[model samples]
Every structure is written in C-alpha cells, then in structure tokens.
Target: MSEFLRSRRARLRPRDVGLPEYGGRRRVPGLRREELAQLAGVSVAYYIRLEQGRGRNVSSAVLDAIATALRLTSAERDHLMHLARPVSRRLRPVARPQRVRPALQQLIDTMENVPAYVIGRRLDIIGWNRLARALLGDFAALPPEHRNLAWQVFLDPSARALYEDWDAKAADVVGYLRRDAGRNPHDPDMASLIGELSLGSPEFRRLWAAHDVQDKGFGGKVLHHPLAGRLVLAYETLTLPADPDQQVITYHAEPGSPSAAALRLLASGQEKTTERTLSCSEA
Candidate 1:
C-alpha cells in the first residue's frame, strides 16, 4: 500500500495539479507530501501516517479526497480502497480447484468461432473452449500450477511471440495481479506466483513495481498465431456475478474481416482434430 501510494505520488508534478512552482531546486520530482495533504484537505502528519502505511481506521472520505488529489481513475480508486482495507486477513489456500459451472462451460463451448476462457482468482485459467485452445496455446497441456495468464505471459516464450504488443499485454497482466494482491494481501498462492515471476522475468519485476492499477474490462489484441497467422481480435471481460472472483473473457474478430475468416478456419480444423482423436480412442 505504501509503495502504491508513493508510486502514484511520484507520477504527478506540482504544475500538473495546479500547484505554483517554486524557484529553488526541488528534491522530489512530484508533489510533496505536504502539497498532497493540502490538496486533499488533510493534515500533513495524518497523510504522512497514511502514506507510511501506519494509519489505522482510515475513513473512506479521506481516501476519496486523496484519490481526487492524486487524480486516480475509478479502477485505481477501487484499488486504493482495497489496499486500505483488505478483503481477507490471511486467506487460506483454496483446497479445491476453481470450477466453471456446467452451463457456463457449455455456453462457451458452443461458441465455435469465438475464443473464450474463464479465469478465477489469481488470474488462473480454469476453463476454456476449443477455439480458445486453438488461438491461445492448449491450456490443458500446461500443468495446473502454471495455468495462469501472468505465468504464461511472462515465462512462456510462445506468449512473447504470440502477442503483437507483448509489453502492453504484460503490463496489463501485472496491473491486474497487483489489484488482486491488494484485495487478498495474504493469499499464499498469489505470493508464490509473484515470487516465481519476479525471479523468472526481469520485465515482470519491473512492471510489478510500477504500481499501475487497471480493470481491463474490454480491449483489443493482435496475436500472431502459428496456425491462424496474424489475427486482430477484440475481447470483452465479463465478471461472473454468481462467482465474482471468476471472469469470462471472450475474443471476437470484426465481422466479415480476414481475422473472422481465420477464426472460422481454426474452428473447423479444431473440430476435425477433436473428431479424429475421439475416433482413435473409440477404436
């Protein structure tokens, strides 16, 4: 939380927030603590305590004031709230694996031309359809421990080659992880994942430290698939209301576009491969 606050503070300039610039050389790059306190209408000492991660019983109003002073987006403000008041003190490692409801799974499976997958807590890929496996690598082939978006994005060489803008995709994954970390501060699984990624990828380490928070609810991605070739897909992330921790992300190509045609071809090939495997098993 302290690091998050400091990073957000470091990103702002005095002039950017309408603060008069002083002539003498300033020691810090962004708004000083006192300046931020003044903007938030809080005492310097109190804001100091909050920034230092020592303030307890912090009120929402004060957080809102600080968020406004920092010009945080809605997603960022929500992250700040989570940091201030974590969801769990020490979340026990979930014993059972996350499962997608049968109905939900069926719905996605029927979308032959769309690539869709479900991600649970820690951004782990829990369920995916045939097209999703074809577009994005085979999630079933990966070990359960490594069936994670962040894990694949950072550690998998194929992901680097798959994403047209690897850096942007990596940053989004880190930001989402950071937000989840704030909500579940003592999640052992999350901590383990972070530690592993930090050791494995320097880029992940750098982006994790940046403290950028966002909810990527909708976005577009350009992927270079080995079989489908270059594809531009727009994705929508929908949170499951029944299971808020789980989200379904579905990717679609523009209608009548080359990417859409590629999706059809991939779906057809996927269907044929599945049928062949089923026949072989039966025989």
Candidate 2:
C-alpha cells in the first residue's frame, strides 16, 4: 500500500495538479511531501510515517481527505480502504469458478428477456444464459483464459469487430480493469492479465497510462450484433451481496425501441438454435 501511495504521488506534477510550489530546488514532480500533508490536512511527520509504512492504521476520514487531496478516483478510494485494513477472518471466499452456483445461474436463466451475465472480480465471464450469449456474441465459447472482458476487448478479433464503436468500448474495459487492479493489488491473476495485455496491445497500454478508473455499477453500451445489427443497450450491474466478488450485469433497451424488438428477435433465434443442438445431442 505504501508502495502504491508513493508511486501515485510521484506521478502527479505541481502546477498540473493545482499545487502552488514554494521557492526551492524540488527533488521530484508533484507536491512535495510536506505540501501534500498540508493539502490533506495531516501532519507532515504523520504523512511521512504513513507513506513509509511505519503506520498502517488510518481512520476513514483521514483516508478520504488524502484521497481528495490526491484526486483519487472512486476505484483508488476503495483500494486505499482495502489496503489500510485487513479482511475479516470470518468472511468466506465468494464465487469460486468450480461451478456457477445454481441460484445465481437460475437468476440469470430467468432473465429470458434481458441479456445478462455473471462476472468475477477479475472481470472473468463466469456464466451467461442464452440471451446474454446472443447479445454479447460467443464470450462463453472462449477458453477460460480468454474469458476476461479486457482480453476479449483487446486480444479477440471477433470482439473488436463486433462492437460498432470499438475505441469507446476498449477505453471502458481498460478503465474498469484499472479500477479493479488498484483495489486488488495483491491479486496475481489480475497482475498477470495486465502484464500480458500491456505487452500485447498498444491500445490497452495507451489507455492504461491515462490512469482512469471506474466503479462498476451501471453504464450504457452500443453493440452491433451480427444478427441484430445496431442496438443501444442500457446496462445495470448489481453486485451479489452474498457473493462479494461476483456481479450480475443486465441489459435493457428503451420501451418500443427498434433495439428492443431486435433483441427479442435475436433471443428467439438463439432459443431455436439451442433447442436444435440439445435435440441432436440427446438423439
């Protein structure tokens, strides 16, 4: 956490970040340690100790103050809290991939009219029913290693071709991933995914450097499905309270909109295909 704080602080520049510099030879860009302490309403000595990891206990109010002073994004604020406190021993691990829990799967299955999916904290598409598959294309068909949203956006040619506005989609994916990375800095899988994408995709690298972060909740997407063509979908992402690391994302179109009608048609076609496949396998 200290390493992360120091690194983030080092990246900011004084004038660029609206900090007035006192006349002196500066050792680095961004606010000096004392200046940052002043801005965050903390003692310079205390801030130094915190940054050096000499102290780990920090109140939420102080953390919030520091976050504001640093202009930390929503993701960064969450990361700060996580790092400052250890996870409770009583808390159980949520949503393992061995099997999508039946209840969650049923919830997704019941959303027959909406394109919905379950995603893990690392942005892995754990499961999706037929409607989601229809709207999102063959995300579930990819190997587990390639099931990551960031990987699909940057590494998969089909995903790139499928989205009508690829660049905006790519930014959103990276931004979301950036937020996750900050929150779970200790996650090796997340680290490996970012490392791999940074090495492989220049576009991902560029967007990542922008330091954008987003909390996962709700957003809008424009998808160009091969069968349904152009559709603007409003999506709501709900975190499963019982499962900390899992979330359900559902897509909806405006009432009586062409996009809504197209989604219905696509869902019907998908159902027919599924029925035929199941029948053949059973036979």
Candidate 3:
C-alpha cells in the first residue's frame, strides 16, 4: 500500500494538482507528504502512519478523499481500497482447480471465426477454442503449469514477435496481476508465478515495481500472426459474476475488413502452417 501510494504521488506534479511551482530546488519530486495531507484534509502525522502501513482504522470517507486528491482512476481506487482493508491471518484453504463449464465452452466454440478463451486466476489459460489455438498457438501442448498468459508474455520469445506493441501487452498483464494480488494477498500460487517472472525477466521486474493496477475490459490490439499476417483486432473481456476469478476474452476484427477475411482463411485451415508452437521456455 505504501509503495502504491508513493508511486502514484511521484507521478503527479505541482502544476497537475493546481499548486504554484516556485522556482527553487526541491528535495523530493512531486508533492510533499504535507501537501498531499493538506489536500486530503487530514493531519500530516495521520497520513504518515497510513503510508507506513500503521493505520488500523482508516475510514472509507478518508480513503475517498485521498483517492480524489491523488487523481486515481476507478480501477486504481478499487485497488487502493483492497490494499487498505485489513487482512485476515487465517490459513487459506487449498485453491481448487478452475474449470470452464461445458455450456460456456460450447458457446465460445460456436463463434466460428473469433478467437476466444477462458482465463482463470493469475491469467491461466484454462480453456480455448480452435480459432484461439490458431491465433494464439496451441495451449493444449503447453504444460499445465506454463499455461499462464503472464508467463508466456515475459518468457516466450515468440510472444514478443506475436504482438506489435509487446511492451503495452506486457504492461497490461502486470497491471492485471497487481490488481489480482491486491484482492488475493495470501495466494501462494500467485506469489510463486510473480517470483518466477521477477527472476526470469528484467522487464517484468521493472513493471511490477510500478504498482500500476488496471482491469482489462476492452481494447484494440495489433498482432502480427504468422499464419494470418498483420491483423488489427479488438478484444472484449467478460468477467463471470458467479466466479469472479474467471474471465472470457474474445478477439474479433471489423466486419468486411481484410483482417476479418484473414480470420476466415485461418479458420478454414486454407493457409499453410508456418507458425511455430508457443513454448514457455526462454529462448
């Protein structure tokens, strides 16, 4: 929580928050702790304790005020609330394996040309359709432990080539992981994945430290698919209300576009196979 607040604070400047910038040397970047406290209508000492992770009875109203003062987005505000809430020390039960319902699997399968898949906690690729396999590579061939999108983005050499803006894709993965971490603080498996990524990729380590939190609902992505060539696809992410940890993400191109025709060709298996299988091993 302290790190998150500090990072957000460092991103803002006096001009951004409507404060006068005096021409003089300042010891720290962004607004000082006192300045933020004053803006939020809180005592500097109280704010200090909160940043130090010492506040035990912080109120929602105070949190809202602080969030507003910091100019936090909706997703970031939710992350902040989750972080500020007290954690339970009770031992967590073993996490059950996530599964896609047969009906839901069938639904995605029926969307002929769309690339759709179901991802669970920590971005695990639990289920996917044939088109998704063609577009994103065969998930079934990967070891169950390596079926996570975050792992592939950082460690898989092919993934870097697969996306035109690899840095943005990598950052999105880290942001989702950060938000999930805030919600599931004691998840052992999540901790293990994060540890592995931190050790494997310097880029992952840098983004993880930024503490950027986001919920990827919908976005446009440019991909250079080996089989379909260059494609511009818009993706939609739907979270299951009954199972908040699960999400269905689907990618589709605009109707009558070249990308759409490419999708049809790929779906029909008319194009010769040239894409290599996705592997989790670092190359």
TM-score of each predicted structure versus truth: 0.96, 0.82, 0.92
lDDT of 1: 0.92
* Better candidate by lDDT, 2 or 3: 3
The digit string of per-residue lDDT tens for model 3 on 10-109 reads 8888889998777576877887788889889999999999999999879999999999999999999999999999466575556678999999999998
lDDT of 2 by residue, 1-283 (tens): 6765775787776775677767777767666778778889999999999888787668899889888888887777787776677554356344355356988899889888899888887788888988988788687667888888888889888887678789988888887787666656566788899899999999999988766666757878888787899998899988878776778889999989999999899889988998999999999
Off by over 4 Å in 3: 91-94, 270-283
Better of 1 and 2 by lDDT: 1
TM-score top scorer: 1
Look at candidate 3 and tell me the lDDT of residue 14.
Answer: 80
Error of 1 at 192 (Å): 0.3
Model 2, residue 163: C-alpha shift (Å): 2.8
- C-alpha lDDT of all candidate models, in order: 0.92, 0.81, 0.91
- For residue 210, model 2's alpha carbon misses the true position, in angstroms, by 4.0
Stretches off by above 4 angstroms in model 2 are 1-32, 48-55, 86-98
Residue 60 lDDT, candidate 3, scale 0-100: 98
Point out the higher-scoring one by lDDT: 1 or 3: 1
